[model samples]
Target: MPSLVPPVLPGGALSGREQPTLYADGALTLRPFRPADAPAVALAFTDPAIQRWHTHAMASADEAVAWINQWRVHWAAERAASWAVTDADDALVGRVGLREINLFDGVAEVAYWVLPEARGRGVVVRATEALARWSFEELGLHRLTLRHSTLNQPSCRAAEKAGFALEGVERSALLHTDGWHDMHLHARLTDLA
Candidate 1:
């Protein structure tokens, strides 16, 4: 028996074409991750903040390379997509990506983090806005959600600046190294009108 409503986005919606490099602004670009970026990724995991929130650390460059390789698989599978956030000179400054993509529902979760040097520069906000635009317009997604620990003030601020509205808090929704954290759920819908 078929359901009355069909998938909002059909299969091959993302895998049909190559993942294109997205321009966030004159100063920032979102591009596919390269093997050379393993070092930067390994270095990023060493940051306590990244480790604490993300709950995983790359112990070596090899591990980072493997992690980078999986993004291609995820893209082909249409389950997720990730990009390296680079500066104008093409230096890896951060990362932004969509995870838990569901074509049927046309939704995905957004995640992002920046190197210590890249913080306070609004890089995440710009990258997120660019991703959101592509997700809604090019990918035909219905909704994009951004969630972060309530303690993560910077992430909360960035989510708001990127036009994600705060829906509510999920109490003790995530487990961190320290303890359970309350998560703030924010969302941006394609049809805001």
Candidate 2:
């Protein structure tokens, strides 16, 4: 029920006021994730596509609650943060997060996934782009990175369309459900800044 717009600030992007909550190609409001979002998160993770690409088991309702709760702890430490991406109707369609923040290097790894219902509609692309821009500009981060198993074409495409250039492939980088395989690393720098 709370507003998603940022607080007042004076500067370039944040100049004189808020950077738009929305950005990129579609519903780009990457706002803070709330505890109340647990139900939707639980539902989204339950989807087959999400579970497959994530290479993990589904989360129970309580696990989803703890996951959402950690967003606050991560935010407080400036180590990482997560946001719920919503449609104009304010239904949560996905989530994106900046994880493993390295302040000494001013970098963070970004991750995201769209619910099956939201895929192919540019939801993840918009959310990721918004999060990347915020990371480089608002958070003063120098770099943001993302990774996906090469077998996941949709995720790789979303990353590319969101302005992340494919960096390289790490062969046998992870043990996915399909098997140990390469991971495509992608990134967007602070060049716009």
Candidate 3:
């Protein structure tokens, strides 16, 4: 007798979501992950730094392919948007994405990583800034958050450099292979003006 779905959202099937092909900010570009990136993804995930912070290690390119498929699934569901970060030469350097999206609340979480060869070059900072700006303006998100273990000083620095101000620390926020780690929460809000 009644349809209770919100007018702003589709009721039956979720469709009409735009999947971006490329997002560029000057020298950096964000594109969807490709199968060709599996080997690179495998190599990057094997890095001790990536494993320590991200807590997921890929032993082979097959696992990397699976991971990429999972990201595709998430995108199809409108649950997350993942991207491959690249340099001007189109070489894969890192990754940045908006995860945990809440359209109704206009909130999302930002996550990123940089390959070992790309470290110390501000890859993540630039990529994240571009992604956050796109999320705020194009996606109509009001706020974006970045969370990283307090032990990850590099990540903390990148978050700050990307304009995400530290909000607070979440005690024992994440459980890594080592143990529970405190997480620093950082956020950026859209300017309504």
Model 1 spans > 4 angstroms off: none
Local distance difference test scores for all models: 0.95, 0.76, 0.83
lDDT of 1: 0.95
Clashes of each: 0, 1, 0
Lowest lDDT 10-mer window, candidate 1?
19-28
Residue-level lDDT of model 2, residues 76-127, one tens digit each, is 6666777888887778888888888776566778888888777778888778
All-Cα superposition RMSD per candidate: 1.0, 8.1, 3.0
Clashing pairs in 3: none
Q: After best superposition, candidate 3 residue 88: deviation in angstroms? A: 1.7
Give the 10-residue window scoring lowest on summed lDDT in candidate 3. 6-15
Clashing pairs in 1: none
Give the range where candidate 2 is weakest over 10 consecutive residues by summed lDDT.
7-16
RMSD of 2: 8.1
TM-score of each: 0.98, 0.83, 0.90
Tell me the spans in candidate 3 whose CA falls farther than 4 Å from its real position. Answer: 1-15, 22-26
lDDT of 1 by residue, 68-176 (tens): 9999999999999999999989999999999999999999999999999999999999999999999999989999999999999999999999999999999999999
